[model samples]
Target: MENKRTEISDLGEFGLIDRISQNFTSVNNETELGIGDDAAVLNSLGSRIIVTSDMLLEGVHFDLSFTPLQHLGYKAVAVNVSDVAAMNAIPKQITVNLGLSNRFSVEAVDEFYKGVKAACDNYKVDLIGGDTTSSMSGLVISVTAIGMVGQDKITKRSGAKEKDVICVTGDLGAAFIGLQILEREKQVFMANPDMQPQLDKYDYIVQRQLKPEARMGVVHELAELDIVPSSMIDISDGLASELLHLSRQSGMGMKIYEDKLPIDKQTYDTAVELGIDPTTAALNGGEDYELLFTVSMDDMEKLKKHADIHFIGYVQSSDKGNIMATKGGNEVEVTAQGWSHFKKP
Candidate 1:
C-alpha cells in the first residue's frame, strides 16, 4: 500500500497549530505557559536570561535535495542551542517559527516535528510556542532559544583580557569538507541519474554537516570545575572568523599556532584528497559549531587536561595585531575568509 498523504489545506492554520501543539508538552519548570497562549510564559528565578534566534532558508542555508526534513528540523534547533551554550547558559525553552510552501504536506510537517521533538528531548528544552504561515519560497525555519545563566557565570565575546589563553572545543573543518562531498555527489548524480551516491566512506564528515550537537556538556563541565571563560563564541563561521570577532570585540590581539589547531584525521585526509589545504579549511571553512573561548592562565591550567579542549593560542595587546604562527615558524596576519551572506558578485 502506498503511504497516505494529507493535504495541509484540509486542516486550517488553527487545526495545524493544534496538531503541532499536542505533540509537545512543557517539561521545564520555567515554562509556566507553553503553546495555546498568546505568548509563552517563563520564570527566571534569579539568573540572567539570554535569548538567541537563528533563521535557516532553503536553497541558501540548506538543500532539500540531500537534507532530510527530520535532520533539518534537528539542525535548526541545535544551531540556536549552540548560541546559548556559547553564553555559558542552559537552554530552557524554544519557539520555532516556520514558513512552508504548498509542496509540503501535513505528513511532511509531522516528520519535521519529529526531529524537533528529538532535539527538545536531547537538549532538555521545552517547545513553548511558534508560528506557521504559508510561503511562496521553500521552507524557512527560525528558532528562538531562551536560556539562563548566573549573573557571574555568563560569558560574552567582549570579555577577553590580554594574555588570556584561547581554547577550542572539538576539531574543525569536518563540516565544510562534508559540504564539499555532498555538492560533489549532487553534481555526479545530476550528470548520471543511474549512479548512486557513494557516501558510505564519508559518513563521519557528512554527519558532521547534517547533524551537529551543541556543546552543552562542556558548559556543565566548566561549571563543575569553577572555570568561567573570559570570552566565548561558537565557531559557526570558521576559526579565523570567530577569532577575529573575539579579537575585535575584546580589543585584544590574538596569536594562534597552526600546529596546535585541531583537525580530525578524516577531515585532514579528505581535504588533501580534494586538493584543499587542511589548514585553510580549518581557518576559513564555516559551520563547525564548536566553542571557541578564552580563559585566564589559571583557569587554562585547570582545562589543560581536558581531552576535548585544545589550547590554540593566547590573547595579546592590540598593537600586536591578530596573527597565526605557521608550522614553518613564520607569523602571518589572519584574515576572515569565511561565510558571508552578501558578497559582491
Candidate 2:
C-alpha cells in the first residue's frame, strides 16, 4: 500500500487554521465567535465573556538554554491577558495545562509555578484549574483565559468602520531584534564555550523579547479616557499582518504613514546593526504583543496625549486596498510575512 503524504507548507498557516476551523460548528448561540480573531467572544447570562488560549512549546516557542522557566511561565499568562485586553474585557480566570520531561527537577517546576502565580496576582486573575502530565520530548504549556466585558464595551475586529483612525500601542521590532541578538550570542558561545555573552548593551531589546508585557494598562486608560476603540486586535503577528486582519474583517482598506510607525531607539539601532531595515521589522516582526486598534476620528483627542499609542493611518474604501505610505512618499502594498511554525520543514 502506498502512503499518502502532503507538505504542511502547501496549506500555509492560515490555510491550516481555516481547514481545521471549518469542521467545528458553533453549537452554542452564546458562542458569538469561535476561531479566527484575537479572541473568542461569548454571550454569558449577564456580561459577555471573552475567551482566548495560547500554547508554548519548549523548542518551538523558546529555547530552555536561554529562556528562564520563571519568565516563560509569566509570559504565558501575559500573552493570554493581552488577548483579553484586546476584547476590552477584564480577565478573571485561567486554566493551565503543562507537560514536563524528566530532565526538569521538581524545583524547576516549582519555579515555573511561582511565575504563574505572580502573573495571576498581578493581573487580578484566578488560577482556577490546571493539569500536569509527563512528556517524552519537551515541555509544553497551554493556558486558557476567561474574561468579562459589558455588551456595549466589547470590541471586535469587525467593528472598524471606514475612516476609523488606526492606532497601535507602544513600538514594534524590538522583540525580533532582541531574538536576533540572542541567536548571535548563542552562536558565539557555541563556537567557544568560554565566551561570556555580550548582553548588557542589548538589555532593552532582550527584555522586550523575553519578558514582554501585555498592554493591560492601555485598556484601563482607554476606559478612563472614555474612548472605546471601534475595533481592537493584539499585535501577536506583526503590525502588517494585524492591519490586514482589521482591513479584511472591517471590509475596509487603509493607508498607514511610514514615518508615523513607532519603533524604540534600541530597536532601530539594533536593526541597523544587523543590516535589516528598521521599517521592515516594524511592519513584519512578530511577538510584539501590543494592541492594534481603531477609533473614531472625533475620539482622537481623547488619546492625543497618549505617550505610547501612535495614530499611523485611517481606514479607507476596500477597493483602494491596504497600503503603507513610505518615508520616501510612495505607497506599497502591505503583505503578511507572519511567523508560521508549520514552516519548520
| Whole-model Cα lDDT of every candidate shown, in order | 0.94, 0.84
Residue-by-residue lDDT tens digits, candidate 1, 1-345: 029778889999789999998888888888889998789999998889999999999988999999889889999999999999999999999999999999999988998998899999999999999999989989999999999999999999999999999999999999999999999999999999999999998899999999888999999999999999999999999999999999999999999999999999999999999999999999999889999999999999999789999999999998999999999999999999977777786
Per-candidate TM equals: 0.98, 0.86
Off by over 4 Å in 2: 1-45
Q: Please list all clashing residue pairs in model 1, or write none if there are none.
A: none
Top-scoring candidate (lDDT): 1
Give every collision pair in model 2: none
lDDT of 2 at 15: 64
Per-residue lDDT of 177-244 in model 2, one digit per residue for the tens? 99999999999999999999999989999998888888889999998888889999999889999999
Alpha-carbon error at 75 in model 2, in Å?
0.5
